[model samples]
Target: MSEPWTLHPDRALPADPTVRGIAREVYAATRDLSIVSMHGHVPVEWFAQDSSFGDPAQLFVVPDHYLTRMLVSQGETLPRLGVGSTETEAVEQDPREIWRRFCAGWQHFRGTPTRYWLEHAFVEIFGVTQRPSAATADAIYDQVAARIESPEFRPRALLDTFRIEVIATTDPAWASLEDHTRLAKDGYGDRVLPTFRPDPLLHVDRTTWREEIDLLGRAADVEIGSYETYLAALRVQRQRFVEAGARATDHGHLAADTTPLDDLEARRVFDAALAGAVTAAEAEAFSGHMLFQMAAMSTEDGLVMQLHPGVLRNHATAPFAAFGPDKGYDIPVVTEFTRSLRPILDAFGHHPAFRMIAFTVDEDVYSRELAPLAGVYPALRLGAPWWFLDAPDAMRRFRESATETAGFSNMSGFVDDTRAFCSIPARHDLARRVDAGYLARLVAEHRLDLDEATETAVDLAYRLPLAAYPAPR
Candidate 1:
């Protein structure tokens, strides 16, 4: 209100000057800290291909489910957000128009995490001094569009500008890690590495299951026709990810269940699934068994495990078939982590080498399930808020709920699981501001000293993620 487009005084904190001052100091200390992104859904090809980004919408809106979900919530629809529909010809295929629609519905994101992120993007990246709305859409768009074309906004340059020390990209078992190889050879060092995500191989319900399984068999030189060989192939792939500088494996399951089964029963289930003679329940059970097996392997190899459950992925089968997965249709469901993860915990929860990070869409589990688990288990660490829960509000909720039990040390810090390279800075900046705000409150309430609060902020922003999911030396 005071200026054409000034950032909110408390954009990342409460609107109290005293608290804001302390937050600013805490944020400053951690602003330039090394970014260690331990998890994300980014395609490995971007780094592998080492290509420049295309356009504004393609780089930002098209790939981000957050933007599309909000647009759809306001009734703009995904097709208008560049989501390809069955009858793609009849859709509003114009990016400019889509951008305008996005600009018009900007109010929907107000007071939400998205708005804070977008405003940081507008101000810090594009040098925009105005909010995104009908009055300034074209101007805002053009400014950002022009800057992205400049040499400074190039991917590698942006990576440097953003102070990114290390970034992990999720790769399926089949990936060759050629880009990661290139990055290291090009003296990029440990800046960009691969994270092994075995979801495609784990979820037997996927249509590409057989093909991926076959590919895994060939990659591992094993007869994956049997369940024994399938597990062997996974071990081989784990080694490959480790060699490529990965110290973590990510599993996105329907639930956190881990059922440890013996040879005969496991073989029977796998054979049934492989031969298409299995029921849905059998496949789920087999998947659960494999989770424990994976953890056992993790104990052997020292690869940290991250389980992000409670997403009913692509619930609308028709939309998934037409538009592909992660198109803003997936919704969070209530999950039971304590009951689901019991079998695995019973087996390897005491193992010194096995480290597991718990991520949940079910916020209710934070106090009831996550905290108590992380509090007691030396092998377990609370994963940073992920997927639908990675916003400022969600981060705040997590800190308030989990800190009492898990504390700052028991949790991994921020992870910029993003594909839009420009958004990297914007996202991390928002996290720092929010963390600073949180710390400032503790200081204001006389619950913490400024020095200790500042130290915790730095750890939350930098050191914790590094220690939680360190890349192999």
Candidate 2:
């Protein structure tokens, strides 16, 4: 028989009895709060059309880089897991086989956050009572498949079930946002919003930059013949996004540098890049300058600027060439935020209209760099432990490191930056549990009172995200 799978009510709480009790109280106080997903990659079309998801493998294994990357590390090829290949080649075409492969490698997820999230979904969302393994994979897949076929398991139905008050979907600068508009017309405007992501347009070194620039110009109905025109086109796009109900702009760059260049120098670099003659160093410099320009735009338009830097994307060329980006080869490197952000922060750190949230995968800079910066700058806030550091211990370390300096208010709150829609509730629940445990220890030590911890828990789970990324006025 397969081992029974169950979720303990007090899972993720402190091991000590007294602290555990305190944590339970704290968690219970805020466990049912509505989610405010300020930044994510979930396609808006899913919710707009209220689409029914595919089989278990399609929902769980195929799209999630978190699972695919781990399986890849264990000698399992991506193609075997239903991941599409870059070259013209056949891959595992059966969803059932992909599900079986995932189950067979379930042991590899032991002691990882991926295991916790998956189990939470299995027990709480799908009502699966048997542990996933090669022996029970078929049974569990059938059960999940049946559950998802029901109308109640549709994407819109699941959104309501997940208690998601609002979610922001990342869109390219040139996106029409037709789905977002449709949702708005359907009276779901208050619930779903768009986030502008201009990475492809900003990174001149990429081969797709020229195409993206043309796309942007066409989207904005502007002719971009100079650097000034390009900036104007970007401004127009931001306005379009704001009109479409976007409250934030998201940037994922290789570095956090935001130094501005003189108009002449910037124009010169733009011309070289436009001609496809720019060097790597010139591209890096131009990208850094664009960060400053983005901040300037945010100051004028009131869109929250979210910067997540230091990710070396597509570290391995073979897989990236065969597959596409976000195949889980992105790795974090040491990032220096303090000096790099000085130019932009110095320019608009105190501007009332400017709001910036800094996210980093480099934990070494949390207390030493991010907290200190956010603690002082009125416009700057620290984003939650993100991407690679969204695990249990890493989150605890973030709170311990940041709270003493920046306090709870400086936090942008828990953002479920995931493409896996069903995993949203599980990810947020884990964050709440971790925060409750952290606060419980503080209350036990008399650093905070129980009532205060309860209120803080609610804010961390719900309120802060709204405050950080408020609906655009």
* Candidate number with greatest TM-score: 2
lDDT of 2 by residue, 175-242 (tens): 97899999999998878899999999998889999999999999999999889999999999999999
Candidate 1 overall Cα lDDT vs. reference?
0.80
The C-alpha RMSD in Å for every predicted model, in order, reads 2.0, 1.1
TM-score of 2: 0.98
Per-residue lDDT of 370 in model 2? 96
Give me the overall lDDT of model 2: 0.93
lDDT for each residue of candidate 1 in 30-89, tens digit (9 for 90 to 100): 877867666766665666555667666777677877887888787876777777766643
All candidates' TM-scores? 0.94, 0.98
Once superposed on the true structure, which residue ranges of model 1 sit more than 4 Å away at CA?
Answer: 1-3, 88-93
Give the runs in model 2 whose Cα sits over 4 Å from its true position: 1-3, 86-89
TM-score of 1: 0.94
Model 1, C-alpha of 19: deviation from truth (Å): 3.2
Count: clashes, candidate 1: 0
